[model samples]
Target: MGDDLPPDLARLRVLETWAAHYLTRIRARIAAVERQQAQQQTPAPTAAPPSRPGTGPGRARTPDWGLAEAGIGVPTTEIHRGDCWARGKTLVPVSAERARAELADGTQPCAVCRPDRVLNRLGSS
Candidate 1:
């Protein structure tokens, strides 16, 4: 019985040693992965430039020359690039022909860009 106990104890010690080695290897692999992730991380932008007006997310500074209908069901109006003062309005892009047609259909051209002048140029050309 004493002899059997020594063999069992030896086996238990071997298992413990194997588990420790496995755990050490796992920890080393995890550390290596963490270091790699850190190296791959992009550095934060240094001294971001001052944001321009109307340049925030989902806001267009220079929108395409087109007709814009207010998302809140306002009448569709001719809008020029960079001239819309109405915030939270979704502007849909249209062609010059469409702009002219829209104006003829009672859609007002943007007072700022004067898209009517563009329509006149298109007519002359």
Candidate 2:
């Protein structure tokens, strides 16, 4: 009589509200900790290498060679340095030698990253 909705349904709704509030609090706490971590960390004094674009806080150390794909049912379009700012539809890891060979075989080089520079720096080493 007092409540318009059924008792069980009302309880479920109450629990759902509580769960959402709890999740919000948990996410806030996690974000606070992440902010603290970012504040505490400092850049290195030595000359360090560049980081990948989306790896987090400019501290990534994962760079190699990769082939950028156009899309499904399409061929790879360009070669990219792992840390290239310009991203393709997809990337497939490959060896430096393979990248060099692919570049030699008419695969387009990424204009932004210029991966070919790394491959041909030594001039046949």
Q: lDDT (CA) for every model shown? A: 0.61, 0.71
The segments of candidate 1 whose C-alpha lies over 4 angstroms from its true place after superposition are: 1-63, 71-76, 82-88
How do the predictions measure up, each by TM-score?
0.39, 0.47
What tens digits encode model 2's per-residue C-alpha lDDT throughout 1-125? 53664468788677666765565466567767877997899967767774554466655444587887765322348888876645343578788888999999999887768988879884477
For model 1, how does the per-residue alpha-carbon lDDT over 4-76 read when each residue is reduced to its tens digit? 4346768867766676556546656776787799799986786987566558799666554656664333334
Candidate 1's TM-score: 0.39
- Candidate 2 TM-score versus the reference: 0.47
Off by over 4 Å in 2: 1-61, 72-76
Q: What C-alpha lDDT does candidate 2 achieve relative to the native structure?
A: 0.71
What RMSD does each model have against the real structure?
26.2, 14.4
The 10-residue segment of model 2 with minimum total lDDT is 68-77
Q: Which is the leading candidate under TM-score?
A: 2
